[model samples]
Target chain A: MIFKIAWRNIWRSKLRSFTVMGSVIIGVWSLSFMLAFFAGFIEAYVSSAIENDLSHIQLHHPDFKKDKEVQYRLKDIEAIEKQVTSLDAVKAYTVRSLNNGMLATATGSRGVQIRGVLPEKEAAITNLDQKITTGVYFDATQKRNPILVSKRLAEKLNLSLKSKVVLTFQQANGALTSAAFKIIGLYQTGNAIFENLNVYIRQEDLSRLMGETAMIHELALLLNKKDAIEATQHYLSQHNDSTQVLVENYQQISPDVNLYESQMSVATYIMIVIIMLALIFGIINTMLMAVLERTRELGMLMAVGMNRSKVFLMIILETILLGVIAAPIGLVLGFLTNAYFGSYGIDLSSYSEGMEKFGLSDVVYTHMQTADYLLIMIAVAITAILGALYPAFKAIRLKPVEAIRKI
Target chain B: MKEVIKVQAIKKTYNAESIPVHALRGVDLSIQQGEFTALVGPSGSGKTTLLNIIGGLDAATEGSVLIDQQNISQLTDSQLIDFRKEHIGFVFQAYNLIPVLTAKENVEFVMLLQGKSQAERDARVKDLLGAVGLSEQIDRRPNQLSGGQQQRVAVARALASKPKFVLADEPTANLDSKSTADLLDIMAKLNREENITFLFSTHDQRVIDRAQRIVTLEDGAIISDEQNAIGS
Candidate 1:
């Protein structure tokens, strides 16, 4: 009977009830959309970092990451590559010989990290071949040492495709060396900071130039599934000499990526709290008005035998019914918005320059986990209950005699 | 006849701390079973206050109210609500039927609160609405019914719990002459046929003319208590 009465009572003032429900719908829609957008932004940032350079996992000579000297090369290059490539989880892998040195042209000299990579394997892992904008990737027909420089770096060096540049670095004996290489390709990764600091060259040419045969310093691997990364890294660790190797994933290699990933949920929680708080006050206001308007009716109910607890429960049921009617509509609206944007992403190309500086893609697709939807439903329920408390209590506190006598 | 209501030196003071308004002063009254009694007085003469105290809707400032030998003044507020549900029925002046419920539902509400099964409540609601001449208006809500029909529904609801007695405070104050006459005929018929006890606080001479006994008040004190041999 209470349920029936409460359900009918809300419709007594249809305008007021709908106004409260409209607030709930808008609150739920905005919260869900905002969280989806935040999730998309963070996903873009992390994936861009990984796809551009991080890969799923990377293995380095124990001391090589500390200093990019030629002397810290992997002890047995062939043996380690053989074991890593044989793992069932290994989707693709690449070996690179790294050297931090200076690049010079007739105009100026700038600091650079020269990455010596095998063309086929690097293409498979990082898709470096597709990033070429003007010239071809390292071709077997090239007669000289072929190098790939970013467009931003080429502008700094006053060089273009087929321009000759001199790379100056160190040998295993601590002697300084310089070699001339031809820039065969100019690539633009949209990340100005990374583009300005790094250039790629053929591994054979760099190894021969440093007076070592088959010398490699880093092994970057892309796994078939992200969840298999820790297991693959563990397998690689057991196969190799642990004292000479350090295997790490993208999060381990970049602390900022890890921080962004962990903070996504915190950001979502803050959004839920903010939206629910606003909804709470709106619901309380509406319910308080309902209770006050029906003072005589409530008093009569008590006078005729309805207890305080049942009256309290009836008010609570009314508030919850409002949420129950509004939440699903809001959820459906949010789901539709997410679906439309997810399939055809929202473009923010106008902010591309700024976004790329932080290694984030210009377009972000809105998406949310199933658990997120469940959390939102639970949050709305709690908010409704909390919002109903003061008004329900006020109703139960009215003395039947005084209330009935109220004129 | 057994005494259904016994009021012993009941006193009620409103705004007692500052400029106290004594609504009831040492009023004593006893009503027996199967009696149709009217408490009549001018404005501020303590008719409603005395009735409220006896019905357990308000606490007496001094003295006690016993309904069928139970001291209602000693009960807690929550306990008083339960006592009202189980023993006393009320018919308000404005026809205080739940606006959201149909006539039948309003009659069945108290029985539901009593935890009566559907079969029992349905049967009682059907029988009581028939008794009140609302047998055809069972599905209409209060707002849809006429003022007289609404009062009829209130009377049905008051009897739904089959309480020991019914308290009506000016139940015909809002009705037209025809509605008031029709209502008095129903109440008088019910008292005669069902032997139900009824106590009313009213200024309407129509109600006073039909009562078996009349209790009049002046200056918050009962000035006359008389039984009409043939109702005026």
Candidate 2:
């Protein structure tokens, strides 16, 4: 009955109730939308890096991860492959040799990152084979040098299907070596960083270029669960004798990962502070006014045998009611805001040059996440109830007889 | 006769702007159960202040008020609330019913606060509202009711707690002659029929004339303590 009375009191002055509710709704919506954007964007970024660029984990010589220069190569690849593939967590593995080389065809020549990989095994680990256009992917069962390169790289080399290209690089022994490979296919991967220079050939061709039979510079492993990369990596590193496991997907391992995470963390904290301040002030003002107006009412309640603490509880319940009324609406508004902006995106056409000056990406869009809405809704509910507590306490502490006399 | 209220030399002082305002000056009074007593005085004679002290709304500066021999001044604030809930009923001149509540709700609020079961509150509120001639107006808010109707609801609220005594602080002051007469008749009848004690502080002639005993005050001091040998 007390709850009913308090609930009805809010509607008795509908404007006051709505004003407080509106503030909470707006605060919750904006805060949730921002959190959603951060979470969603980070998810997208990691997926892009993992699937598009780096595999989930890599196995190489102990010094290879530290130096990253192509000095480390495994001579006995079959032994390492058998042990790694036996693990249930390893979805697939690819042998890759990252080499610095110059590509030449009739039309042009450019320095490129020449990746020597087993086409079938690389297909399972990396998205490169799936990106191949214009011709078939390289068949590992076939003869010598069958290479795949990006459309941009192939275009720069002026190579078509079955067109021959020369790749020149220095071997591990510091001897200059050159090879000719048929351009069986071309790929147009969207990343400009790799698209301009990325080229692929068979591992055998790379071994011959390095003048070391069956040598691999890097062994990259893919996993079904990206989150379990650390566990899988730890197990692989401890169990393996010759190979050192570098535990990272490209997305997880990026140098910019901390920068992005910290940026997101700071943004979330600021947004919460701004939102909670506004909401707290909003609820506190409403409840204070409610307290002042209900002075005599509260006193009357005390006169009727209500404990002062119970009176406070009743008022706090009213604030909780306000939060309840507003939170679902706020969640919907947040979702709508995120969906609208996430899809259509906020165009920075006017500030493109300004953004370029800062070197940030082109557009700003608010993507959605469940965690975002959850955090804001919880905060909204808590803040609303908390904001009412002091005023409620004040109202309940009033002297019943004095209050009755004053009115 | 059951001793309903015994006030012993109650004193109350207020400090307004650093000046001591003595509102009650050692007023001692008592009334039996089922007695209708009127406490009358002009404005600022501390008539209302005396009523507030007895109502457990204000703490007496010195001395004690014993209702049913329970020392009210000694009770904590919460205990005082419980005392008010269990033993005291208050009717205010402004007809101080909760304005947002319906006539029935205002009456039922007392029992609700007392932690009375729903059936009990419902039964008492309905009976009391009917007794105050407000059964039909039970659904209306204070604004929707006339001044007379609002005061009737306040009376019903007082009675709903079934306290040993009902204290009216000029409960009929804002009423017209007809409503005032009607309210006094109901209270007077309830006193006789239910053995419920009634006390009032009023200059209103109807209330004083209706009283079985009259205690008069002037300048925070009681001047006349007279009981009509022949009752109204």
Candidate 3:
């Protein structure tokens, strides 16, 4: 009966009730959308980092991390490759010979990290062949040594496809060696910093120039399932000789990526708290007005033997009913909006330059965990209950004698 | 007849900390079971204040009120509410039925507060609404009913809980002569048939004329208390 009265009482002022519901609906919808947008933004940035630079896992000679010298190249490459290929979780793997060198063209010279990679293996792991905006990816038919420079790097060097560039670096014997390579292709990744610093070349050409046959410094592995990353890293870490080879996951390799990923949950919770706080105030204002306007009726109720607790409960029930009705509508609207945007994506092309500088993609597809949705629903329910307290307290505090006489 | 209400030397002063305005001055009154009584006076005569005190809606500045021999003045605010719920019924001048509720729901509300079973509430609502000649308007909300009909519903609601007595503050003040007469007739019939006690605070001669006992007040003091053989 209290429920019946409370339900009917909210409808007494239909406009006011709808106003409160509208605010709740809008708050929930915007909060959900904002959280998903942030998640998508972070997902785009982290995935770009992983896909273009850091694979799911990496293995390197332990000393290579301390110094990028050519002498720190991996020992027993065949044995390491055997262990990596045995894991079903590894979808693809590649080995690279890394060197810090200076690339010089007719116009200028700049520092660059020359990555010597097996063309097909590197292409399989990082999808490197697809990033080519011009020319071919490490063509075998080219007579001279072939190299891939980023489009940004090509512009900075004032060079284009088939242009001759000189790479100078230290050999395994600490001898200064210089090699001339023709740029076969120009690739563009979302990361401006990465594009500016790194260039790729064939492993055989690089190993031959470095005065060694198999000069593998780093082994990168891409996993089929993201959820399997930790377990795969654990298995590899347990199997490998840690003192010789350092095994690290993408997060362990890139601290900023890990930081961004962890902050996503914190940012999501902060968004929910901020939105729910606004809703609490909205609900408090509406319920307070409802209580104030019904002073005489509340007095009459108390005078007729309705207890203070029952009166308080009725006001709370009314507020909760408003949330209960509006939250699902908002959730559905949010879900549909996310579904549409998730599939089609929200194009941030207008801000692409700024986003790309931070390694983020222009088009972001919204994504949220099922747990986040449930958390938001619980947050709104708690907000409703919190919003009802002050108004309910005001209601229960009314002396029936004075309230009844209130004109 | 057994006494249903006993008010002994009850006094009420408003704004006591500043300029005190005494609304009730040591008034003593009692109503027997099955009696129809009126507390009558002009404005500021303290009739409503006296009725408020007797109804447990307000505390006395001095003295005590015993409803069915329970000293309500000694009861805490929360206890007073429970005591009122079990022992008292009120009908306000504005026909204070819950506007959101239908005629039947208005009468059934008090019974619900009492935690009466649905079958018990339904039976009593039907009986009481029928008694007040509102059987046909059972589904109509308060706004849909006329002033007379609304007051009749109020009367039915006041008796829904079967209180020891009913306190009405000008129940007929807003009604036409015909509605007033119809309301008085229903009250008189309930009093005679079911032995329900009624106390009213009013300035209306019609209500004063129908009371079996009239307690008139002036300047917060009872000036006259008399029983009229002419009224039943």
Output the number of the TM-score-best candidate.
3
**DockQ: which candidate is best?**
3
Q: Lowest-scoring 10 consecutive residues by lDDT in candidate 3 chain B? A: B223-232
Worst 10 contiguous positions by lDDT, candidate 1 chain A:
A64-73
**How well does each candidate reproduce the native contacts, as fnat?**
0.82, 0.70, 0.86
Query: Which numbered prediction scores highest in lDDT against the true structure?
Result: 3
Q: Could you give the CAPRI-style class of model 1?
A: high
Candidate 1 error regions (>4 Å):
A156-158
Interface RMSD of 2: 1.5
The model with the greater TM-score, 1 or 3, is 3
Task: Give the distance in Å from residue A167's predicted Cα in candidate 2 to where it truly belongs.
Answer: 8.2
Candidate 2 regions with alpha-carbon error over 4 angstroms: A83-92, A100-114, A117-124, A129-170, A175-208, A227-231, A242-252, A258-274, A332-377, B228-231
Q: What is the lDDT of candidate 1?
A: 0.91
- Candidate 3 segments whose C-alpha is farther than 4 A from its true place: none
Q: Give the per-residue lDDT digits (tens) of candidate 2, residues A1-407.
A: 77878788889789999998888787778777778766656655445556656677776676766665566765566877887778888788888887887888777788888888777887877767678877878874667788888776666556788898898987888777888888888885555565676788887788777977666777888887877787887776666664444444454456565466568768887888788978888888889998888787787778767788789888999899989999899889888888887887767668754543332334557776577667777777778777998898789778887676665
Measured over all alpha carbons after superposition, the RMSD of each candidate to the real structure, in angstroms, is 1.8, 4.7, 1.1
Give per-residue CA lDDT, model 1, range A1-407, as digits (tens): 99999999999999999999999999998988888888999988877777778899998888877777688888887888889877889899999988889999989999999999999999999888999998989878987688999987888778998899999988767788899999999988766777888899999988888887777888899889999988988888888887888888999999999999999999999999999999999999999999999998899999999999999999999999999999989999998998899889889999998988887778999988878988999999999999999999999999988788875
